[model samples]
Target: MTDQRQDAIPDAIPGAVPHTRGVRFAVYSAHAKAIDLCLFDGENETRLPLNRTATDLFALHVAGLKPGARYGFRAQGVYDPDRGLWFDPSKLLVDPYARELDRPFRHDARLSTFGVDTASLVPKAIVTEDRPVAPAAPRLPKGGLIYEVAVRPFTLLHPKVPAALRGTVAALAHPAVIAHLKRIGVDAVELLPITAWIDERHLPPLGLSNGWGYNPVAMMALDPRLVPGGMAELAATVATLHENGIGVILDLVFNHSGESDRHGATLSMRGLDNLTYYRHVPGAPGLLVNDTGTGNTLACDHPVVRRLILDTLRHFVRQAGIDGFRFDLGTILGRSPQGFSRESETLRAILSDPLLADRVMIAEPWDIGPGGYQLGQFPPPFLEWNDRARDDIRLYWRGDGWKTGRLAHALAGSSEIFSAHGLGETRSVNFLAAHDGFTLMDLVSYSHKHNEANGEDNRDGHNDNHSWNNGVEGETRDPAIRDSRRRDVQALLGTLFATRGTLMLTAGDEGGRSQQGNNNAYAQDNALTWLDWTTLDDDLVTHTARLARLRRRFDVFSESAFFTGQDGDVLWLNEQGKPMTTADWEQPDRQQLTMLLKTRDREEDRATRLAVVFNRSHDALAVHLPGGPWQDLFTKDHVFSPVLPPRTVIWLRELADPSARDKEAGES
Candidate 1:
């Protein structure tokens, strides 16, 4: 077929756009000699060569081609792999801007082989018509809780969820799911990667599949498996969440694509323009920069890549009304050959863009590259995952020495790290556990990672988890061991909730979901990873709910400002109720401490003081209070005897007394 192009067509906008006459298909490939728009009609294939309308763009307008048409691209160019050129006309390429995929990507050896016709192997990109949803502001509160969720595993075995909607994005809108989120007081749900992804080439050989959708191929296309209804389903789910006072934050992976290393699949970007889409060694174009530990890192500094990322973000915001985004391996976004910078062009663009300015931006601020651990370096308006807090909290609860100061630092919003620029509020997304590591229950039940099922010989996950088994490792029938583990989990949860800054809870962690001690259960898509809602620990769920309510009810728990010891804003006290001196903080075996804070009781609309006592010892400790008329924050019982249970965190609030009320006000 002869090339056809119209000067009126906007070549700058890459992707298939349906218009009055037909569909306008455009793709960007700086190095391709020629590109073909391969249309699929059942078993028949029609190849139409595209005209090089722009310097680096191919464009064509095909009449009668409508929205629901399945198509792929094939580029005919130099086929040198050593010099970073992988143009093979036999390989079918998905559109970089594809909004929908006809099927999920299936990896095969032929996909990476040269001269292999992969029209049947690769998933076809479907031409879709855009239906923009009404724009709305983000719904995440400043210090709200973000519940990290993997779509399929979260609802796959949920007894209340419908069978048909068990593992789909549409199921998130179901009343059962929403009720669970509301019960745990999840202000926002950070859905893990829902984009179309191919299994790691190594997985299918081992009879395993990628349960976590971290490996992405199509950046914009919603996975036909996870999101069956495409953009419409996601948009509707977001609307439903917004109606229930919860927000939706997509956990996006832009650091790398599923194309993997040089031996990886010849997918869309790699075939279209490998040299342009990915970062390569300066002297050796064939050598890719493995910054993300995911084969190849995206050349995010490139103009083409920057535009694609921005366009993708805008599309989600405009079409789905998405509230925010949590960037996985986020350091890659601001990295260049010179290393990472907070003022990178892409970071600036996302911050300056009118449409994205108000959205919540969170960064998983680390990768495997040089200078990748940029914990507190992200600029304002971008909250970062604080691994420091996670490790310190775990170490403290594991009966480590001299961790009291570290725990205090984390609980107070980690001022030393976040306050370097003199910022009053912390930009930390504090959490005890996340999707990448052990669940909350496992943190107190497993001493070491039990990833035997991952086929990697248990060397995949974190080595030093800073975890401890109460008495016995793994699951035990001993009631004492079980009760000890439960108490430790509750204490950890209480510590997380009482900490200052934004909070994040992995889905099912509130109700004690375990991965059989497998910290890296990314490949176990079966019952091992699925959350068994029927057998969830109801008492733990209740404890989590109460913690959530306490966090919301007391303005102190949500305060963004850093606490100062002056004026009773905050005080670290010993078990004797006196200000903790250096000797007390340095006590290696001391596991009991009190955190006193001046706060406002929102329920009573009165200013009151709160004391959070933590005891990690095996024996209950008697603690003295400086103030009178203290009551249990959750139980509402007067603190007749100030004694903390073993491995427990007790919250005590000063009761309102007419006699001492005015004196307390005067002192403040």
Candidate 2:
């Protein structure tokens, strides 16, 4: 007899597909005894049995079924949770390949109980026809800045955004949003997850929700709540961003699903093939592996799981015109039974794929699993988020002793960390603050975390923030304290822009947005997290814009190669105008230093040198330089001054020739 798998359908792909006559549905399950397809139409349900076309494959073709049809699966088999078999015919399972969900997935207590009919509680997958977008190269420059944005919070309070368009993907394309992005010199916007996700079981009782979108259920489906227009909304938004020269990168959570521990809901993958989709303990099959702190981890090394991940990525790139992806808890992607490996098959496949080869790939590079911190270990072309830079930068500004060298190392792209892997250039994405922690304004305003608002009783965020309040904690009316905090914020922005490698700035960090010391504000969807455009410090905004302009006008700031300390590429100087000796660098109380670089002025088109001076002392310090014809980039002062302000960072450029001086004079 001929093979039934090949004879059933010729080169059939999984999920529901609409063709001329009708729609064909395919699902995969390694342990299910039988599976049935359930179609829904206005409170009426129809069940159709699917034939086992191939090993671990169940498929069926329903005549006259078209797009927008709502459907789900029900698998029949052993109902033993301890042995990793969770098949229940009464529970309506969502198709793993679902590209669109009829509605958002809501948490219900009956979802986990066996033999409980839950067709009403689960979201039915809607059949969608793919509208392919023409392939385009990612627009972000190698060392350009990436602005991290949480869509809803970023646009919810914007005055220019229409009330109806606010809190949706379409709002990102608004002129106000795009104009703000342009002012900050943003090359791309790294949006937090827009995929459909269910709130954590503990959130509903507390009257809070997961605003960060880290917990995802369907890999391919866009959350209906965030994108009501579904794929079309996202596609059009991307096209609009591209029109104004901004790329979009999605922050995806492949490490774990919204499905929590054993008691968690079995929405889709857990109900269809628990053993195959999720990772379980070696000897104890019933016990799930909690690599990600959220709950059970994905079995990324498995062939079926790898194919799903690849298809999901391809779907985003081909259908929605996404430029790139940032993998949350990315170590799990290279993880297996042995451990996390840099040479994992899934990582290699993504790098080699035709459609995805040139796309940007970023990794968080760490998880909570055994040996999970894999910083600087991802293969080439993958940039890793540099927590080392974040901590060291904070420490230096907090007046920690013996951190001058550490600060210098971070400013130079943390070569000590990335160079160990024999890489020629740095792959570090440097930032002082991110979505998971306190904002830049809060970093200097609150010395300790005040997480009482998170419902965790002040126990949710990081304790040692390496932060210091100028004089008062939280908000204050004292002008002295306010001025001190503003200077600190400006110094932090200057230091970040002066650093080598790619840069990232969380949404409102440049203009003094804060979460009131709630470092972990993942659950605060209210005004606490929204960007208050009206109350922004205009001085701080101008300073940030100037810094961005300097970074763009100077060639050295965007260079990715490690400085060799030769050919005037880099120099570290002390207060005495001499090269930093061993004793000077070893001083615990060292608060003043200078970094000199040989660079070219992009606009002037001439070779010049730049000096970035740092003063952390409480009093103004007189600093000496080894050059003449120096002009302060910010103050536009042609005359050189030896006195540097306390807790300030100044950029001084060495005028190359008479022509350059004349040009500067003409502009002034």
Candidate 3:
């Protein structure tokens, strides 16, 4: 890792003119017979003939043009979706890697909604615009809490925030939002996507706008609409987050772009280099392989495509001060021309890169391609969103049978899955809810998805949610049922913080954020998705903050590296403190489990040990505690004897000065 000094300095801010020379552009036009370039010089425009290569990449060498300079590309061709050719020279095409968009696209009078029409409502391009870029912030990974959130709704309707700043990247810096995050005790905010994106032409017809920014257009640049301040505004937010001791972990979608199948949009790499950018249409001349389930998957195997991906990341880290990234459908990044290979150049390059090693790198670890699930396959210094961890944890606490062993491995960091990589507990980015599906609240509120509000007739999101609502399907007025459900939430949070892995939490899950049983709230931008910051139930918010505080108390929970202990740092036991039996592993009504976790590598000061007891049932149950002086992490009630509770979780920690519990609370 480079010194935390001058060498770690980020790239020059975007608004400031980069002293380096000429303009750099990447243009795409799939069916253009000829292409032209235009530069905006106030009202008057300059034109130039782009030099064409065999791959159809048009390049123009120009003087006096640099970053923040406004420019666009014009392609001439027959525009048609049925014939699968869309090229309109009159429409201006924005560079896919534009550092900043000229302006946000309005759905009103002048817009580009053309799939493949010569004359279209939507243009396959954007105009020239520049937003100021701010100075970069220092990236920090130490004990950082990862809060994954969708960009639009997180701040869109936040009552305390200004309307203009809502739904934009610049809003991230807004005092109200940042103050909330700081108060919540998160170290980093994992934004879903901030890149330029396109809502599917088909989705708009359904009266629903896509909320999740999964379909990407530009890779390296910030979406102009995301920031009313543009690139300059986005940069300033990074500085603000850093100043506040929070890091930014972006959820990047390298697996695919907004360009759907061959007959879809033509704004980016698909236009500039089709056969090289996207997987070719199978047995068809101009079709595109839709491995991403969206429309087209990027060709990660191509040498040039690989370079673009790598450069995009480096540019962001060097310039954007991006503390880390969680790659969407990341398994695709490791596939080669022959097939999926862990040794693929893309993986090797990222792992070995000098510039990127120190930054956090997380992966979604799956794709739609054959044999595309590579959950435990990413290299070291990397973390993965452990689906096994998510499912097993949910199953264990939901009172599912024969799950003790499954639960053990999950809480112990799924060593069997990631052990081959010499990874210890921290590599598993454990979570129960993410942006793709159900929120934690709905995880217990509904057994099946209720996505009718998404206008997909409840067919849009995942079905097998592994959620148990304590004997009810939705909200309940019965205090016993409601309290029991809240207890399950408490248990899950306790288990997550007590486990021996670094954690990545979905944004609103801690405070019981729900989509009203709609697991997929990706298309609803209203209150259905926006966090009700105004009325977050006090009990849920208290539990979430307590979980955050508890994680900090344990070294294993907060550290970024794997546990290097000789014996297992985490051990599982039954009520008898014996090994789990076959019967205990399979009984559906039995969801109680116990764990002991060593908090450090034995080299750190203020050593601590944790014992966690859990029960996922409605009836009150007693659980045995290890014979040690234990202070309840949440309540600080000292327990020197066996301790148990009904449908509850109790966290016990070994503190150096247990008697002065009041002193610790005051300092905190």
State which candidate has the highest TM-score. 1
lDDT of 3 by residue, 1-668 (tens): 11123222233111112334554443433345666666666545566766544444555445556655666566666666344455655555555556556554323212234433322332222333334233244354454568887777777778877888888887888888887687667888888888777777667777766677788777766666675565456567787888888888888888888767654555645544456577765555366667679888888877666767777777677666777788898888888646787788888888788777777888888887788888888877678889988998887777656457777777767788887756554578888888878888788878888889877678787889899777889878899887777887887887776655667788777777778788877778678888777757678878878777666656666554444444546666677765557777665566567777666524335545677777666555666644456767667466534546766777776555423643666698
Lowest-lDDT window of 10 residues in candidate 3? 7-16
Which sequence of candidate numbers ranks them by TM-score, best first?
Answer: 1, 2, 3
* Model 1 per-residue lDDT tens digits across residues 1-668: 22334466664479999987899999998899899999999968999988876456788889988999999999999999899999999999999999999999998999999999999899999999989988787888867999999999998888888899989999999999999899989999999999999999999999999989999999899998899999999999999999999999999989999999999999899999999999999999999999998899999999999999999999999999999999999999999999999999999999999999999999999999999999988888899999999999999889878559999999999999998666778999999999888889999999999999989988898988999988889999999999999999999999999999999999989989999899988888999889899989999999999999988888986777888788789999998999999988888888798999888889998788888899989898998988667888768566646778899998888876634876786799
TM per candidate: 0.97, 0.97, 0.85
Name the regions of candidate 1 deviating beyond 4 angstroms: 1-6, 657-668
Evaluated against the true structure, the overall lDDT of model 2 is 0.89
lDDT of 2 by residue, 47-117 (tens): 99887765567888888989999999999888889998898899998888999998998888888788899
Cα-based lDDT at residue 657, candidate 3: 47
Give the Cα error of residue 657 in candidate 2, in Å. 3.4
- Candidate 1 has an lDDT of 0.91
How many clashes (backbone N, Cα, C below 3 Å) per candidate? 0, 0, 20
Residue 415, model 3, lDDT? 81
| Ranked candidates (lDDT, high to low) | 1, 2, 3
**Which of 2 and 3 is ahead in TM-score?**
2
What is the lDDT for 415 in model 2? 90
